[model samples]
Target: MSPAFNLETCARPNILALEPYRCARDDYKDDGSNVLLDANENAYGPPLADAVSLTSAAADAGLDLLGLHRYPDPHQGDLKEQLCALRNTHAHTAQTLTPANLFVGVGSDEAVDALLRCFCVPGRDRILVCPPTYGMYGVSAQVNDVGLVKVPLTPAPEFGIDVPAVLAALDAAVAAPDYDVKVVYLCSPGNPTGAALRKDDIAAVLGHATFNGIVVVDEAYVDFVADQRTASLAEWVLEWPNLVVMQTLSKAFGMAGIRLGAAFCAAPVARLLNALKAPYNIASPTSTLARSVLGPAGLAAMQANRAKLVAQRERLIEALPQIPGVGRLRGGTDSNFLLYEMLNSSGEPDNAVALAVYTKLAEQRGVVVRFRGKEHGCLGCLRITVGTEDEVSRFLEALAKTLAEVRQ
Candidate 1:
């Protein structure tokens, strides 16, 4: 009946997009631009600059670590501007993602929860997930007291979403009296499965006629994917208003401890999230470190590290299947991790062996891998994260020994 889908129409009515609480530090964003007496910060600066140890990058950024007395910028204008430029470098068919298209948070988890709170009314609205994916999506749903509908991804080795099943679930939920599906969470280069979803498949969901809820694509490991500038769906925010692309610095920027993440979406959706978040969700140190690492040198460093990881990943892929008890690799070659099944006496996947292999390696040898044999279609599989050259070599030796010990 209407011309097109509107995000507001699908969102919870009570959850209005109110203006964010303005902070005194916000006005003094430009360094040495104003007197800055409004926030009542100590003009004396920190007494113990000696207590801090600055990294080369941080020192190069020339941030005022002494300015810890003042609150952080609620708008995060500068950081968002840099991130927008990074994303815009990949824009071709889609328009540029400005500061308006971004929402920064404490890891991607905050954005996930924010999306749930902004749209779904707890107990009345539900969300959908393609299983054998990230567990945080379900954790966030439960935390918000919202319901979930799970449509498992395809069988082992491909873990792609069942598009028909997803649409069918949405259509069925619509006819029900009390169930309204509000959001869909998908992991690209999926967590344990490690496969990137085909672009066309995502397009199909975005173009769905009956389902109006937004779709979120978590690209936590996007930096590890080949040709990331082309593979990322971040630029899709301009083309698909109902789409949200989540990314993080933890995986590639080597800043997991920093706990910073970003969500790129339609400018309106982004503004809505900004309005809903706390007055100052990001801390001064976090923003400073983020700015330091988002520059040209940081990107080059990350890419060089990525190249090492990719080479190690290929090393594992070629060698893992050759082991006596190891079966074929189960997922695509996109992520920093790989999933492979352990073989039983008859050469079929065997959970007992997989668990034994996982236990023996971690306990006796200090090698740790996730035992994901129970996840859908991941029978007897163990997920291994790509580590440093020495770590990978050590893991390979340890894994072969563990498998031999377990099989015996």
Candidate 2:
């Protein structure tokens, strides 16, 4: 069947109506030369730092490499081959991921945008996403004119996944006659909540989508989970064509600056994404850096970082709750970020208290954190990205002082 769903009937009417931006053929294919023609990239030296070296705290991390004079591989062939081994999910069972099954974007953020562009019709079509999760999901949906149906995560049992509620949303969307559940976005080890979706919950959603639709499991933070191997749904996508597992090199591999990310799915889904994506979605340097990072040494380093982050997270779990006014600290079993709720001024549950604490940390302690607000079951909550031991200690010290001030 052709992928031509209703452009108007789906979401992002604005996107469908507007002419898509097109790139010339030369923009994507690189013949490997000193001079470049294609996307009018600034004829200049590479940045100050290498992809790996860029992560260090050093100020001048970019290195001006001369290879900037060429186009990147539009298909991302090498990167996909490496990802296949890393993901442990070969395309044809025996192998062959090929350029057909993969599309590389600036980052996973771009992958999410591409997914919306391909599947969502905008303005007419609708998507279902859980809140207290990634805001980008909603933003990307809106950008594509796709309507969002939010079923927020429940905050009470420590921001537990409201599986029944999500299922109900799906059922309602399907029954509405006007809407079909085009995509279900689940963030395991959800942001702010710092808890992974129960495997059963994932299975149920995948089953539902397999029978009647599509579900995209985003494992962006999966590497931080204690059991990283099980935190992803990459393998399942092979069994369920409707499943699209999205991942990025940003979190674990520490390649956020390079902006490289990938989506794993059946060839058909990959085709749709490719057709919708810009010809040269990934930069040449980005691919080169990604290739270097996805090798054995890079993967090992990522695993080591994950191990260190997990250890630090566990340390926080034990040390954070001891501070007064901290109602709870939730983490582990999935994800590197942590969620800490603060006791209200009235000694009751309060997201405001948490917000105030986050503010104090940034303003007074000069510590930055992403506040999830009360929207996604993280009422009175703060999402702290795990850092080095020294950084964590600094945070804890400031946090202790902040809590003391708040309590009094």
Q: Which candidate is the best by TM-score?
A: 1
Each model's backbone clash number: 0, 31
lDDT of 1: 0.86
Q: Candidate 1: RMSD over Cα atoms? A: 2.3
**Candidate 2's residue-wise lDDT over 1-408, tens digit each?**
113223244334454444435556534444445345557866664564465455343224232244455445566777788887777734224443454566677888988888777666557667788877788988898787889988877654455557888878877876786756678788776765667777667666666532255678788887776655555667666666677788888888889999988888777677667666777778766776787788887778878887898899889888888877777664444677777677866766576667778889999999988766556555676778889999999999998898788767
Most lDDT-accurate candidate:
1
Per-residue C-alpha lDDT of model 1 across residues 341-379, encoded as one tens digit per residue: 999878989999999999999999999999999988889
Q: Please give the range of 10 consecutive residues that has the lowest summed lDDT in model 1.
A: 51-60
Q: Score residue 111 of candidate 1 by CA lDDT.
A: 94
